[model samples]
Target chain A: MAHSGINLIFEGQNLPRLLGGLWITIRVALIAIIAGGVLGIFLGVLRTFKNRFLRFILRLYLEFFRIVPTVVLLFLFYYILPKSMNLNLPAAEVATLVFTLWMAAEASDIVRGALISVPQHQVDSGLAIGLNRSQLYYYVLIPQSLKLMLPAMMNLISRIIKTTSLLLLISVLDVINVGQQIIEANQKQYPQGAFWVYGVIFVLYFLICYPFSLLAKKLQKD
Target chain B: MSWQIIQQSLPMFQKGFILTLQMSALGILGAIILGLMCSLCQYFKIPVLKQIVGAYIELSRNTPLLIQLFFIYYGLPGIGLKLSAYTCGIIGLIFLGGSYMAEGFSGGFDGIPNSQIESGKAIGLSQGQLTRYVVFPQGFALSIPALAANIIFLIKETSIFTVIAIPELTNTALDLIGLYYHTNEYLLVLVVGYAIILIPLSIILTWLERRIRYGTFGD
Candidate 1:
C-alpha cells in the first residue's frame, strides 16, 4: 500500500523526534538515579544507626512513599506544588524531583536491607580492631553492602526508567508523548498509525529496560 | 481549598473510588488465574510453554502498564480489536499483574521441598493428587506475602487508568481541577481516598499474612 502505516514512523523526521523524546526520559532517570543514589546511601547508613527517633522518622518517610502511588506523587508535584508554593518550575524538573524522591525512598530501603544483612560479627570485629565507627563503615560495611545492593539498585534503575513513562501524563514530552503526537498528526493520512507508533514505543522501552533487568538477574544469581 | 467545593466533589470522588475498587478487584482476580496458569506451566516443566512463560514474564516485567494500556487502548483498534476503555484497563492490569504474580507464585513453587514430593509419592499419591494436596497449599501459603504485595501494587497502578480517560479517583480529581481550578481541595480528597483504601488494605494483608503463616507453618 502506498500510504502504509509503519512508514509514517520513518516519514521525514519522526524517528529522530522520538529518539529526542527518549533522551528526555533518559536524562530525567539519570539525574534521579545519581542524586537519589547518593542521598539514599546516606539515609540508609543513618537508618542503621542506633538513633531511635531518626529511625522512626525514616520509617515513616519510606512508608509514605511506599503507600502512595508514583502517579499521585507526580500529580501532587506537577500540579499542586507550583500553585501552593507560588513557584514556577518546568514539568521536567517536577518529574525529576518526584522520581528522585521516590527513588531515594526505595533505594534507602534496599540499602538498609543490604547493610543490615551483613553479619554483625564482622562489624564487631571491625570495631574490635581499634577502628573508628566511620572507618569501620567506610572500610568494612560499605564495600560489603555495595555488592548486596547493586543488583537491587540496577532493578530500581530499570523501574525508574519504566515509571518515567508516567511523565507523559504530566506533559513531559517523553517517548510515549511524542508517539501520541505522531499518531495524531498522521491520523488523517494513516488510519492505522497508532498501532505501529505505540508498538515502536513499546519496543523502545523494552530495549532500555531489558538489559538492566537481565543484569539484575545475573547479579542476583551470583 | 474551599470546603464547599470539596463537599460538592465528594460524590464524584466516591463514584470514582468505587470504580477503582471494582476494576482492581476484577483485575486482581484475572491476574491470579493467569498467574496461576503461568506458574503451573513452569512447575510442570511443560516444554515449549515454559519458555514462552519465561519470555512473557521478562517482557511484561520490563514494560510499564501505561505503555501496555496505550498499546491496547489506542493501538489494538488498528488491528480490529476495539475494546472499551474499561475492558482495556482491566486487560492491561491483568497482563502486567499476571507476570508479577507469576513470579511470586513460581517463587512459592520453588520453595516446596522435593522431600515433600517424595513423601507424597511414597504414599502412592498420583501427581495430580500431590499437586492438589501437598504442593498447592504449601506453595500458596508461602506466596501470601508476595501475592498481597502484588494486589496492593495493582491497586496503586490503577491510578494510571486516568490517562485512558477512565473516571477513577485521579481522573475525577483532575477533571474537577480542570473545571474549577480547585487543585488543592481535589488533590487533598484524592490523597485521602487512596490512603483510606490502601492503608487499611496493607494492614489487613499484613494481619492475614501473619494468620496464614501461623496456620500453615506454625511457629
Candidate 2:
C-alpha cells in the first residue's frame, strides 16, 4: 500500500483542512437549525390559523418543500437563483439557505403536530382564566408544545446535521468534501485512500449525530 | 428556457426515469426485507444477533447516507469488494432504507402485546408460525403509516445516487444541463420527473395507510 492508516489524514495541513471543514459543517447545521426553528415555529403557528388563505398558502409552502429533494433545491438555489435573479451569494450561503428551507418546512410539521397535540382543555382553561393570546401561548400552549416537540425536534436537528452532508454535492467543502479532497490529493499516492478517508468521515458524522438521537430517545421515554 | 430542447429530451428523461423507479422499487423491497429481519431479531431478542442488528441499524441511522454510499462504493473497493455504481447505489439505499424500515417495523413489533404471542404458543404454534401469523400481520398492520413514510423517504433519497454518476434521473438532468446550458429546462424536467414518481407514490402510500388503519385496525 502506498499509504497506511491515518497517515493521509494527519499529513501536513490535511487534518486541519478536514477539521476546518467539520467546523463549517457544524456551523452551517447550527445556523440552519436555529433560523429554521424560529421561522418554523412562526409558520407552524400560522398553519393553525383559522383564515383560509393563510392556511392554504402555508400548506403550499410546506408541501413544496416536502416534495422537492434537497439536492434539487441545492442545485436550483446554488445555480439558477444566482444566474437568473443575480443573488450573488456564495455557494455555502446558498446551501445554507436551501437547508434552512428544508429544516423550516420539516420543523413546521413537527411543531404543528406537537402544538395540535396539546389537549383542548389546556387552552380552554387558559382562556377561562382570561389569559390573553400572548399570555395563553406563553403560559399554557407553548410550554406543553415544547415538551412534546423536544424529542422530535432533537431528532430533527440531528437529521438536519446529517442532511448537511449533501453539501458535498454542492462542493461546500464539508467533511465529506474534505475527505474527497484528501482522496483526490492522494489518489495516486494511495490507491485505497478512500477507505481511511471515508472511515474517518463516518466517525465524525456518527459522533455528531448519534448522541443527539440518543438524547432524543432518552428524553422521549422520560 | 429551451422548451424545444426539453421536448426532444423526453426520451432520455424516460430512460433515466424508469431506472430511478427500478432502483427505488428494488431498493425499497430489499430494505423492507432486511428491516423485517432486524425487527424480528429484536423482537425475539436473539442472542448476539440482536445487539449486532441493533447496532447496525443505529449506526446506519446515525451516519449520513452519503458517507455510507461512499463507504460501500469507494471504500469497499479497497477490500476488493468492488460493485457497479448502480449496484452500489441500490445497496446503499437498501441498507439506509432498511435502518429506517427497521425502526418503523420495531415500533409496531414492540407494540404487539405479549399476550398475542403467548396465545400463539398456547395454540401449539412454533416460533416461526407465531412470527408469521401472530406477529408479522399485526405488526405490519400497525406499521403501515411509518412504513409508508419510509417508502416516501426512500424514494426521495434515490436522488442521492447522482453523486456516484448513476445515470438516474438527477444525473441525467445534470448531464443534460451541462450539454444544453438550459438550466431552467433541465431543472424543470428533473423536478417533474421526481414529482411523477413521488407524488403518485405518496398519494398511493397515504391511501394504503388509511386503508390499513381502517380496514385492519378499525376505527
* Per-candidate iRMSD: 0.8, 0.9
Off by over 4 Å in 1: A1-3, B122-124, B214-219
Best by TM-score: 1
TM-score of chain A of each: 0.97, 0.95
lDDT of the candidates, in the order given: 0.92, 0.88
TM-score of each prediction: 0.96, 0.95
Q: Which stretches of candidate 2 lie over 4 Å from their true place?
A: A1-3, B113-132, B214-219
Per-residue accuracy of model 1 over B1-219 as CA lDDT, tens digit each? 678988999999999999999999999999999999999999999999999999999999999999999999999989889999999999999999999999899988888778888999999999899989999888998898999999999999999999999999989988988998888888899999999999999999999998886243343
The clash numbers for all candidates, in the given order, read: 0, 0
Which candidate ranks first by lDDT, i.e. highest? 1
Q: Which CAPRI category fits model 1? A: high
lDDT of 1 by residue, A32-67 (tens): 999999999999999999999999999999988888
> Candidate 2 residues B77-97, lDDT tens each?
986899999999999999899
RMSD for each model, in Å, please? 1.7, 1.9
